[model samples]
Target: MKPSLYIATALMLASTSGFAQRPPAISSPDVHADNTVTFKYYSRTAQKVSLSGEFLSGNHAMTKDTSGIWSITVGPVKPDIYPYAFVVDSVPVADPNNTYIFANERFKRSIVDIPGNTPLVHALQKVPHGKVSYRLYPSKTLGTTRQLLVYTPPGFNPAGKTKYPVLYLIHGGSDTEETWTKVGRANFIADNLIAQKKAVPMIIVMPYGNVRPAPMPDFTKEVMQDIIPFIEANYPVLADPQHRAVAGFSVGGGQTLNIGLTNTSKFAYVSSYAPYTQTEEFQKNFGATYAPNAEQVNKQLKLFTISVGTDDFLYESVKQNIAMFTAKGIRLRSDIVPGGHTWMNCKQYLATTLQGIFK
Candidate 1:
């Protein structure tokens, strides 16, 4: 109607449009100098909130303050990276204030890093870094294009005359290809290990191991047929079995047993970490097809190792597998450590594998 009246009304509306009523910013996963961590979550209407993480023995209840913020400070935790989540009224949720996440298909958890005085193997250190590249490859077995991550060692050159060994690494069930690099910090571990001359420079191929809706066993086919050929063709890696290795964690670890043991001529190094072998495919292969040809398999494989944490749920099964291999006169190295089935142990297993493989 009137110019001055319209301007006055616009200003009045803008002032009441809820911008200034926004809640204050909250910081979560605050790591203290003493290695203790403070986790915070903002919720006013929640009945209860609790914290669950690898660092703690059990879920710890969080106290709510007047500002609708629920928080708990736990641990002078042993300096390492851990995945934690807040259970708000029985529902697990990632910290809204923390951006670092645990890369998995089934969990929405946030990551917290408590740095040690010395850099952890998975920690980013002042060393020559490797490049993690995401690449798409055609999966003839799966009948689609799939994505995978490749970690090339520092100073990698495509046209260079030097060729590197290849490690076909796989992730756990419900974990994506990026889990190895993102959650497990495989690239950083490799960087630190290579810089220290503990491990040789090599190429690592992390492929998506889930082929659900399709038979779970088909993943072994994809890795053997599609993924291996793609990496060998594209990267300057040695193609022979002597220079090729296969390793994985959880369900992927079971696949490692299937793919590596059944095809011992293809993979010289087979490292399975806390493998979940209670699968139909694992039984079908290890029971029928495997037939305990331990002598021949032992001859073909240069290194066969299985690692498991004592507190892992699958520890008994893994120990049984180790015993079976030992009884069959197959040479195997067992790395039994203290901890559960977690990415923390995965990093330890990988660091050890890097040191042992391709030597």
Candidate 2:
């Protein structure tokens, strides 16, 4: 074959292969005007596909098309951000069509944002936005360098005379620091709250709370010794405990109790949301034999609150914890709302916390 003939043959074959291999374009999590969302997944070989999300009470089946696409249209779902996944065969996987993902160590789920007619707190509005800075800090307790996210409110200036208060926020178990921003929409929530003057201009530090392959207790030390000091040294933040707050959800909620309660001199405001307190740390810290100096703790803490949903799995235990705290003469504020241990509830909890804290 001559050179021109060979090149022409190869080009024709390549064009044919490319056309044959290309998949049709499709959209997952197409939010409709009515608030219903249609989710799609392209899989030719899968035996089964189902949609699972916080929006639905149970798993909904997906219908497969002749084009090897599986899809399900779900809900005039309550306007909120939700994590959903397609379970192919038996394994749960994130929607390949959707780029927004739930930031966690364990779950591979995609996010769908359904907007309300009225603006939701987590919705991205035309408000003055804060900046989320990814920073690396040295963690002496963990013997390694760690990453954290800092949210500086609108008009934040490191060189400015206005020093802001700090909120050390922690995510749930298996959730990375980014979960607070990506899934929970903490920055947008803060931006909206601050714009409306509902929340004071402050700095929020979301640290990686999972210290695995090492004892979980080390995270408390890391927060106390490393993260706080790094924030104070690097940012124009209020240094005293009176201007500092600590809060978390789920496993990090348990961590909040460990870190904040133990060192009342560090956090003036401590809030735990749907806290999963059934841990060795919780037992060790607030165990049967452990008795806290309630008066001293009350005096040191400007605010001590625990918020949990009525339908949460940990509701009974949370109620028990509340009762125990009350019995021990510890002044506590409990916000019992209706929902479960989902990120949807997490946003509401954070919004309330923002308004309540640093007041």
**Regions of model 2 farther than 4 Å from truth:** 1-22, 213-216, 287-290
Per-model TM-score versus the true fold: 0.92, 0.92
Q: What lDDT score goes with residue 18 in model 2? A: 42
- Give the alpha-carbon lDDT of every model: 0.90, 0.88
When summed lDDT is taken over every stretch of 10 residues in candidate 1, the lowest stretch is: 17-26
lDDT of 2 by residue, 235-305 (tens): 99988988999999988888888788888888899999988888765677765322557888899899999
lDDT of 1 by residue, 19-130 (tens): 5433446789899988888989888889999999989978999999999999999978999888999999989999877888888888788889999688898989999999
- Predicted structure 1, TM vs. truth: 0.92
Inter-residue clash pairs, candidate 2: none
Clashes of 2: 0
